[model samples]
Target: MVFKKFTNGCVNLVNKYLPDAFLFAIVLTIIVFLAGMGITQQTPMAMVKHWGTGFWSLLSFSMQMVLVLVLGTAMAKAPVFERLLTAIAMSAKTPGRAVVITAVVATVACWLNWGFGLIIGVLIAKEMAKRVKGVDYRLLIATGYAGMIVWHGGISGSIPLQIASGSAESLAQQTAGALTAQVPTSETIFAPFNLIICLLFLIFLPLVAHAMMPTKENTVTVDPRIFEEPPAPPAHKFTPAENFERNRVMWIITLALGYIYIVYNLVTTNFNLGLNIVNMIFLFVGLTLHGNLRRYIDALMASASTAGGIILQFPFYAGIMGMMTGVSAATGTSLAQVISNAFVSIATPVTFPLFTYLSAGIVNLFVPSGGGQWAVQGPIMMPAGVALGVKPAVTAMGIAWGDAWTNMIQPFWALPALGIAGLSARDIMGYCVIVLIMGGIITSAVFLLFGGMGWF
Candidate 1:
């Protein structure tokens, strides 16, 4: 009862104080800018230049993120996809069951692909909201976002995937030759400790979220009318172009041709999965399931509006990444590097991973990009860990968890899920604060125990 009171208090506080996500980004930008000037003593103009350089840097990445939402939402709109999701949602006959089921499914989906996980969670939540009475809609969306806390430990994780396949040269250069060889997936993603962590979250996060559900009087269920499905397009006689647009056979043939390359690449690349490949899978699956070009295009258009927040917000984050990592000519170190080095300076072997996790979580607030954070911290922490007798994979996983850990409170990544669920970040972030605290304790304990046991 006391714990529930504390959780409810957090929700009320965030709802009172949390601004819109875009404003949060702006405030964060100001904080980083001022911090950079104070910490590095770099001139404001120099910082502005760095910010401007990075403002457009995420154009490609931003598009990929946009497509993750657009494609996943589109795919979910297909009749088959709707039926499958509805069947899964129907199992949750009660409010607690709805929350638990959403968290578990979202966790597994996020493990496969973070982008897909984000959309699927809310879509399932929406379905459950329609069928289940007394489920808190805000908490359901928050549960969807909470699933992302395990993504960095999963198959599609960027840091592990980068090291396993392509970042060796860059990593070597960044670490100043202290590390050279690639760290394989066997040592990172599929490693015993990482798998154990993923399994625990898969088991426990749902329970934690189930416990956080508001009471019947406090619950905020969504209006079912908000999720009314769009009507099917009317049939008509067609011109040549129109006939091509409606042709299912043409789409199937094209999908078949795309899959050949996809299969060939997976075979050649030893089944390595990357963000681009995940997007391709979403695209092909969405196209095939929607049955024809016209309907698929319609699905895509319907889902496109959900991407506005992501589109408007990511470049600012990219610029924030730039400011966080950009070096000062006077100080000769970036703010991110300085923040990392502070934690590294006080570390013993057992505490190295713990401090690294804590520091990564802090740095993640300012530089939320996993790849970007790794670029800044990986080179610094990995080398320091090696000198202290910790393994490279352990150090890398610490950084990965740090990136995923703090995301429970960060509204940037929550944009997609929030947009789909028709809720503001403030509506859901209180439950996420509980998730952030619970997840922090879990991951930190794991790192400490394993670090002490020399289990890594």
Candidate 2:
């Protein structure tokens, strides 16, 4: 009952107070602009210049992010995956089971690819809600978001993968001691400690979400009609061009060609799974699952509006990142330095990863982009980790987890999921706050114990 009250109160508070994501981005841009003026030696004009120049710095990265969400969402809506989700959702006859299964499936998807997990989670929740009567709509959405909790520690975590890739070596140009060599996934994503924490959350998060479900009288449910998917249009006689567009023969050829490229990539790259490759993998898998050009195109078209919100908001964050990073030498200390040093001051061998995690969480709120955040804090944190005797991989993972940790409350990463759910951040975030707290505790304990044990 105490938890129930807290959840309800939180929901009410957030829904009432929080602004739309666009406004939130605008506020962050203003805050960072002012913060740069105060903390750095740059003149107002210089700061404006920095913001302008940096606004488009993430153009390539921004496209990659957009595709991940757009393509993944497109893939999930394909009939093959839809039927699969519906079949699974049918087994969840009770509201409690529906929420748990949604979390489990989302967690598994997120563990594989954050984009995949985010889209699939929302779609699955909608399907489950349609099949199962009486589930709290808000909690179901929250459960879908909650399953993404494990993404940072999962295979597609940005920081961990950044350090693993050859491209991370370019960071040395920015800071004196940023990592100049690749760090392997074995040390971070696949580490024993990380795996242990992930497994525990898989078992634990569902029970907590299930228990948090509101009572029947207090539950917030919408008419199931809202959850209903519109039926696909029936096929009719077609012209040659239309027939060619819908032809399964061409789709089969496309699928075969896509698989060949994917196979060649895996073989030549020695199974390297970078962001672009991951997106391509999703593309092929999505095409095959979708089974034809016309169906796949329809799914893709449905994803555009859901993706456009995130696309519009990312530039503001890039501007903020630019103003924060492009500091004048005369200021004598960068905000990134001050932020990193705050945690570094108290860090020792046993506690370094914890502080790194905390600092990354703070930086993440302001900087938001995982790659962008790392480019700032990574330089400072990487050397500090080596000095304090935390393995580079552990330190890297610490930052990765920290980046992912605060995302439960950070609205940027939730854009895809929220857009698909037709809800705002407030509808889902109150429950995510609970997850943020639980994940922080579990992750911190694991980091400390493992660092002490020399596990990773």
Candidate 3:
């Protein structure tokens, strides 16, 4: 009861202060601008230039993220996907059970693929909210978002995969020759320490979610009516164009081509599953499962609205990344480098991973994309850790875990889930802040205890 009260208070406080996500991005931009000037040698105009230059940096990444949410939501709207999600959601008999189950499912899903997990988690929460009366819809969604806490330690984690698959020449260049060879998954994602952290999150997060549930009077349930699928348009005799839209022949040919390339790529490239491939798989699978171009188009149109926040907000974050990584003429260091360097300066061989984890979490606030964050911090931290006697894998995973850790409060990654749940960042972030604190403790402790020991 005391814990619930505390959780409620946290939620209330966030609800009071956290603005709309777009506004939050603006606020962060202002903070980064001010901090850049105050800490670095850059003039105000230079800071603005940095922001402007960086604003468009994520255009390619922005599109990919858009599709991650859009396609995932579209796929979820397909009858088969909807039925599967409903069945899973129906397993939760009570409000408390609903939050617990959503948390577990989201965590597991995130472990497999963060993008896949993000959509699945919130979709499941939305489904549960429809069926499970009295469930706190905000808490349910937040529980889903909490699953991201383990993402960097998961199988599809970018940092782990990057180090494990990076070409020796490219990695050597990125890490300043500190990492000339690939760091296998066994040394990072599947490492004992990393596994322990993922397992702990999988175990305790559901309990945390259960404890955070608001009381009956305070619980904010979703209106199931809001989720009702719209009726399809009336059938009509078709012209050639219309027939093409509705026909399975075209879709079959498209799917065949897509699957053929997918198989060829898997066989030839040793199953390299990057973001583009993930999006392609989602696109083809969604198209196949929906059974016709018209139905898939309808589903895509229905889910397209959810991409608004991502479209509106990501560039500002890209600019924030710009400010964070833009080097100051006077100090010769970017804000991100300054932050990373501070942690490195304090680290010994034993504490390197812990410090790296801590620093990455901090940097992630400004640059939320895992790949972007790595581009900024990896070059700096990797070599530093290697010099301190820490294994390259340990250092890399520290950065990975760090990037994933603070995502709880970072609204960037939450956009997709927020869009799916029809909630603002403020609505769920309060609970996520709670998850952030506890998860930080869990990951920090794991890194401190065993991160430097090199399980590989």
lDDT of each: 0.89, 0.81, 0.89
The C-alpha local distance difference test score for the whole of candidate 2 amounts to: 0.81
Residue 354 alpha-carbon offset, candidate 1, angstroms: 0.5
List model 2 lDDT by residue over 211-318, tens digit each: 788788878787878756688679778899988998988898988888899889989976756678888877888888887898788878877777777788888878
TM-score quality measure for candidate 3: 0.97
How many residue-pair clashes does candidate 3 contain? 0
Off by over 4 Å in 2: 167-175, 178-181, 231-235, 451-456
lDDT (Cα, tens digit) per residue for candidate 1, span 302-347: 8999899989999999899889989999989999999999999999
Better of 1 and 2 by TM-score: 1
- Angstrom error of the Cα, residue 48, model 2: value is 2.0
Could you give candidate 3's per-residue lDDT for residues 1-456 as a string of tens digits?
888888988999999998999999999999999999998878999999999999998999989999999999888888998899989988989998999999999999999888888888998989999999999989888998889888888988998898888899989888878888988898888888889999999999999998888888998886899899777679777899988898888888989999999888878866766788888889989998899998899889888998999999999999999999999999899999999999999899888888999899999999998999889998999999878888888889889988998899999999988888888999999999889989989988887777455442
Query: lDDT: which candidate is best?
Result: 3
Cα displacement (angstroms), candidate 1, residue 385, comes to 0.6
Q: What's the ranking of the predictions by lDDT, best on top? A: 3, 1, 2
Lowest-scoring 10 consecutive residues by lDDT in candidate 1? 170-179
